[model samples]
Target: MAEDLHEIVARALMLDRSAITDDLKYNSIPEWDSVAHMALIAELEAAYDVMLDTDDIVAMSSVGTIREILKKYDVEA
Candidate 1:
């Protein structure tokens, strides 16, 4: 599941899987800007088959935070 998360993020951001890390945060890099953040949210929802609420979406500012938010939907990483 961790690998899946990394791949999804990489795909959404047009980044290599190797570029993704636990410390990676939204808007921290060129590829993870606001546009990519929305794309990422869509990817995560599709991949996990879970619809994120606006609060969850807003809280998904980092990889670690994403994991936490997914957990709230019972989508464990």
Candidate 2:
């Protein structure tokens, strides 16, 4: 499940799975700019079948935070 999440993030951000670390945040990585953030959100929502709220989208700063936000939608990490 975790690997699936990593893959989704990596693909959305155009990064390698190895590059996706817990500390990886929206603006922390170059590929994770605003545009990429939106793409990532879309990918995650589609993959998990959950629509993230605007607040959750803004709060999804890091990989850890993303996991926590996903939990709110009942998407296990």
Candidate 3:
């Protein structure tokens, strides 16, 4: 799951894999705006095979926050 998350962040946010960090935040940079956020969510749902609830979607503020959300679904990434 972490691998998938990494790829999603890299691709959707246009960040290199080496640039990925736990602090990756939506709109924190130009690449993380609404379009990228949508792309990231789509990528994540496809990879994790679970739909995100509204609250989870709202709470997905950063990579660190994403980890916490995924944990609720029993996904360690």
Candidate 4:
């Protein structure tokens, strides 16, 4: 699950997996801006087989937050 999350985030943000740290936050880097964020969301949803609501989407500001949000949906990462 952790590997999947890192791969999904990396692919969505056009970044190397090593760059996806728990501290990585949305809008913190050019690759993680709004457009990439939505792409990341789509990738996460598809990979986890879960739909994220508006609040969950908004709350996914960082890798740590994203893990927390996925936990709410029973997705352990």
Candidate 5:
């Protein structure tokens, strides 16, 4: 699940795989803005085949938050 999260993070941000992490925050860098946030959510839902609740979406303000939210969905990370 961590690997899956990393994959989603890296692909959504268009970063190198080595650059992906749950600590990578939203808007902490220019590449991770609101648009990227929504896109990332879409990518995660697609990759995991699970729809996120609106609360989950709103809570995903950072990568850490994202990981926590995914865990609530039983993503195992």
Candidate 6:
């Protein structure tokens, strides 16, 4: 599941697979800024087929947090 999450984040943020780590946070990666945040959200929605709430969007801060947020929507990642 982490691997799949990594793929989505990497593709959305235009990052290499190695760059994704458990400690990775939204703004920690330069490319994971506002613009890419929206893109990442779009990618996740498309990939997982779930629409995230605005609260969840704002609450997503790190890879771990992302996993938790997705779980709220019944996403296994």
Local distance difference test scores for all models: 0.89, 0.88, 0.83, 0.89, 0.81, 0.88
Q: Higher TM-score: candidate 2 or 3?
A: 2
- Residues 1-77, model 5: lDDT tens digits: 34567777888989888986767877888878989888888998887778998877877887778877887777864
Each model's TM-score, in the order given? 0.93, 0.92, 0.88, 0.93, 0.84, 0.92
List the candidate 6 regions with Cα displacement exceeding 4 Å. 1-3
The C-alpha local distance difference test score for the whole of candidate 4 amounts to 0.89
Encode model 1's per-residue lDDT on 1-77: one tens digit a residue.
43478888999999999999878998889999988999999999888988999988988999889988898889876
Alpha-carbon shift of residue 19 in model 6 (angstroms): 0.7
Q: lDDT tens digits, residues 2-68, model 3?
A: 5667777798777898888898787788888887888888888877787889889888999889988
Q: Assess candidate 6 and give its TM-score to the true structure.
A: 0.92
Task: List the candidates ranked by TM-score, beginning with the highest.
Answer: 4, 1, 2, 6, 3, 5
22-76 in candidate 4: lDDT tens per residue?
Answer: 8898999999998889999899988888999999999899998999889898999
**Which run of 10 residues does model 4 get worst, by summed lDDT?**
1-10
Q: Model 2, residue 45: displacement in angstroms? A: 0.4
Top lDDT hit: 4
In candidate 6, list every pair of residues with a backbone clash: none
lDDT of 6 by residue, 1-77 (tens): 33399888889999998888757998876899989999999999999989989999999898889988888888888
lDDT of 5 at 77: 46
- What range of 10 consecutive residues in model 6 has the weakest lDDT sum? 1-10
TM-score attained by model 5: 0.84
Model 3 alpha-carbon drift over 4 Å, by segment: 1-4
Per-residue CA lDDT of model 2 for 3-72, tens digit only, reads 4788899999999899988778789768999999999999998999888899999999999899988988
Q: Looking at candidate 1, what is the lDDT of residue 35?
A: 88
Residue 11 CA displacement from its true place in model 6, Å:
0.3
